[model samples]
Target chain A: MECLEVYAWLQAYLDSGVTAEQERAVEAHIRACPYCRRKLVAMARVVNALERTSDISPRADFTRRLYEALEEEAGHPLAPRPREPRR
Target chain B: MDLRLLERCRQGHLEAFGDLVSRYQSRIHTLAYRMLHSREEAEDVTQETFLNVYRALGTFQGERFSPWIYKIASNLCLDFLRRRRHSTVSLNAPIGPEGDIPREIADETQLPEDVALAGALGLDVQRAIDALPPKYRTVIVLRHIEDLTYEEIAEIMVLPLGTVKTRLFRAREILRVSLARSD
Candidate 1:
C-alpha cells in the first residue's frame, strides 16, 4: 500500500478494526517503510496520551451541590418517597 | 440503563430520580468538563442537565438512558461555550478554595503532589484538546473520554455517521500536529 492509502486507513488499522487483508497489507507496508512506521509511532503516542488521561471527578461536594440545585429548582425537598399514599 | 429506576422515575418516585443522578453525575460532569474546559461551568452544566432530565423524564421513551443524558449535557455545554466565545479564561485560573486549576480538579484521582509533579505533560495534551474547535472537541471527548461508539456519538451529536468519522479523524490529526509542535 502506498503512503496515502496507509494514512487514510491508519486509524482503523491502529484501532484493529480493519479487515484482515487490509491489516496485513498495512503491516507489510509499515515493515518496509520507515517513514510510515514513524508516522504510526507518532499517531500511537497521541492515542496513548488520550487513553491514559484519567477520568476526572468534580469537587468533593459535587453530589451535594447538584442535589441542592435540583431541590431549589424542584421547589420542594427531594426526599425519599413514602411507602403509602398520603390522603 | 436501569429500567427499574427509569420506571420508578416515570412513576414519580423522587428517590428513583436521585438514583439516576447518582449513577450518571460523574460521567455527565466529566463530559461537560472536557467540552467546556471549566470546572465551574461543567458543574453548572451537569446540574442543568440532570434537572432537565428530571423535568423531561415523562417524555423519555428511549430504551437507553445514557445517550439521552449525554445529548442534553452536550447541548448545554455547547451553548455555554457559544455564549462565552469572546471571553477566555485561563485553564490555570483558580477554581477552588485550595487554589487548584481546572485541570487539577479534573483528575482528582491523583494526589495533589503527584498531579503537580506529572501534570505538565498532561496539561499540554489538555491544552491541545482545548484548542480544538468545539465541533472537533465534542466528538473527541465523546469518543475517547466517554468511550462512546461512533453510532452513539452520531446519535448524540445528531450528525451523520460519516460526518462524525470525518470530524474525529480531523480532530486527531489536529491533536497530532499540535502535540508535535509543543514537543
Candidate 2:
C-alpha cells in the first residue's frame, strides 16, 4: 500500500509539486524504507540538479545568422519541403 | 509578429519571410541546440527547420505556430539522431566551425561556486540526455525543458498518451542512473 502510494507520487515529487501532507508521508516512508528512500533521493537529486543547471543562451548573432540562413535557403529552388519526396 | 505576415511570407513576400525568421529563429535555434547539444548542428537544424517552415507555411492551419514549428524541428532532430546512430562516428565529440565557439557565460545570479556546480551538473545532464535514444530524448526535452504538457508531447511525437508517459518516466530514470554513475 505504501509502495503504491510512493510510486504514484514519485513523478510529482520529482517535479517539486508534492503536497505538504504527501511530502510528510513520503519522507516518513523514506526514513523507514531504505530502498525506497535511496531511489527517491536519486530521482530527486537528478531533478534538482537539472533545475539548478545554468541555461546556455545561444550566440549573440543567432537570430541574425538564422535569418541569413533562412533567406539563403528560401532563395533555393530545391530547399527540402516538409512534404517533398525523398529518394 | 502577426499571422498575416506569415501569410504574406507564404505568398512569397521576401520581407515577410524575413519577419517570420525574426520571430521564430531564436526559438527554433534554441530547440535545435538543446536537442543536439552542438551549436553547429543546432544552427544547421535551425536553418533547415525554417526552410521547411517557409515551404509549408501555406499548408499551416490557423492553429498555434509554436507547436507547428516545433513539430517540424522535432521530426528533423529525430531523423538526424536516427541517422547518426547508424554510423560509427561519435557525435559527442565537438565538430563545428573553427574558433567561433560561443563562450560560456556565468549567470549573475550564481556566485562563483554555484556557477561552477551548475556548469558541471549541466554538462553531465546534457551528456546523459544525449546518450538517450532519440524517441525518449525527444519526449523528455519537449516535456521538461520546453514545458509542454503530456498532450502536447504526444502531439509533437505523434505518440499515444501511455507511450508518452512511459517514455518520459523511463527517460528520467535513465538520466538519473547515468548521472549517478558519473558522480
Candidate 3:
C-alpha cells in the first residue's frame, strides 16, 4: 500500500472497520515501511490520548444552579410555593 | 428515553422535567465544556439547553430523547462560539514560566489511574483539539468525546453522512499532525 492509501485507511484500520483483505494490505505496508509505521503509531497515540481523556463534570453546585435558573425561567417555583395561612 | 418520564414532562410535571435534567445534565455539560473550553460558558449552555428542552417539550413527538437533547446543547455551544469568535483566545497561548499549555481542572470523579495518565498528556491533547477549526472540532467532540455515531452527528449538524465522514477524517488527520508535532 502506498502512503496515500495508508492515510486513507488509517482510521478504519485503527477502528477495525476495514475488511480483512484491506487490513492485510495495510499491515503489510506498515511492516515494510518505517515512515508509514511511525505515522501510524503517532496517529494511534493521538487517538489513545483522546479516548483516555476524562469526561469532566460541571461544578459541584451545577444541579442546584440549574434548577434555580430553570425555576426563574419558568416564572414559578419548581415545587409548589408554600401557601399563606388561610386569610 | 424513559417514555413515562417523557410523558410526564410533556404533561407539565415539573418534577419529571427535573428528572430529565438530572439525567442529562452531565453529558450536556461535558459537551458544552469541550466545545467552548470554558466552565462558565458550559454551565450557561447546559442551563439554557434544559430550559429550551422544557419549553419545546410540547412539540416533541416521541422522537429519541438523547439525540434531541444533544442537538439543542450542540447548537447552543455553536452559538456561543460564534458570538465569542472575536474575543476567543487561542488554546495554545503560553502559560507559566515554562510556557506550558494550561491544564483543564481535573475531574475528581474520574478513576485515579486515568486521571494520572491524563495529567501527563491531557493538556496537550486538549490544546490540539482547541486548535482545530470549529467544523473539525465539532465532529471530533461528537465522535470521540460523546461517542455518537457518524449518522447521529450528521443529523445533529444538519449535514450529510458523507460530509460527516469526510470532516471526521480531516479532523483526525489534523489532530495527528498536531499531536505529532507536540511530541
Poorest lDDT segment (10 consecutive residues) of candidate 2 chain A:
A78-87
What digit string (tens of lDDT, one per residue) describes model 3 on residues B1-183?
556778997677767776776677777877887777777898899989988987787888746788788888998987887677657654443245543333343323434433432323476676677666777778888988888887899988889988988888877877887676666
lDDT of 1 by residue, A1-87 (tens): 689877757777766668988888888999999988887888789877777655556666766776777788879887762222111
Question: Per-residue lDDT of B1-183 in model 1, one digit per residue for the tens?
Answer: 477898998887878877777677777877887777677888899889988987887888888888889999999988987777647664433344532223332332444533532323376777677677778888988988788888999999999988998888877877787777778
The list of candidate 1 runs beyond 4 A from truth reads A81-87, B86-121
Model 2 clash pairs? none
Work out how many backbone clashes candidate 1 has. Answer: 0
Off by over 4 Å in 3: A80-87, B87-121
Q: Model 3 chain B, poorest ten-residue lDDT window? A: B99-108
Clashes within 3 Å, all models in order:
0, 0, 0
True contacts kept of 2: 0.27
Q: Model 2: per-residue lDDT, tens digit, B1-183?
A: 567778776666667766666566655665666678667777778778877886677788855777778899998887777677567555342223531121232223423432332334566576666667666778777776666788887877778988987788777877777777777
Candidate order by lDDT, highest to lowest? 1, 3, 2
Return the TM-scores of chain A for each candidate in numbered order: 0.84, 0.61, 0.82
TM-score of 3: 0.82
Question: Which of 2 and 3 is the better model by TM-score?
Answer: 3
Candidates arranged by DockQ, highest first: 1, 3, 2
TM-score comparison, 1 vs 2, better candidate = 1
> Which 10-residue span in candidate 2 chain B carries the lowest summed lDDT?
B99-108
Model 3: share of true interface contacts reproduced: 0.41
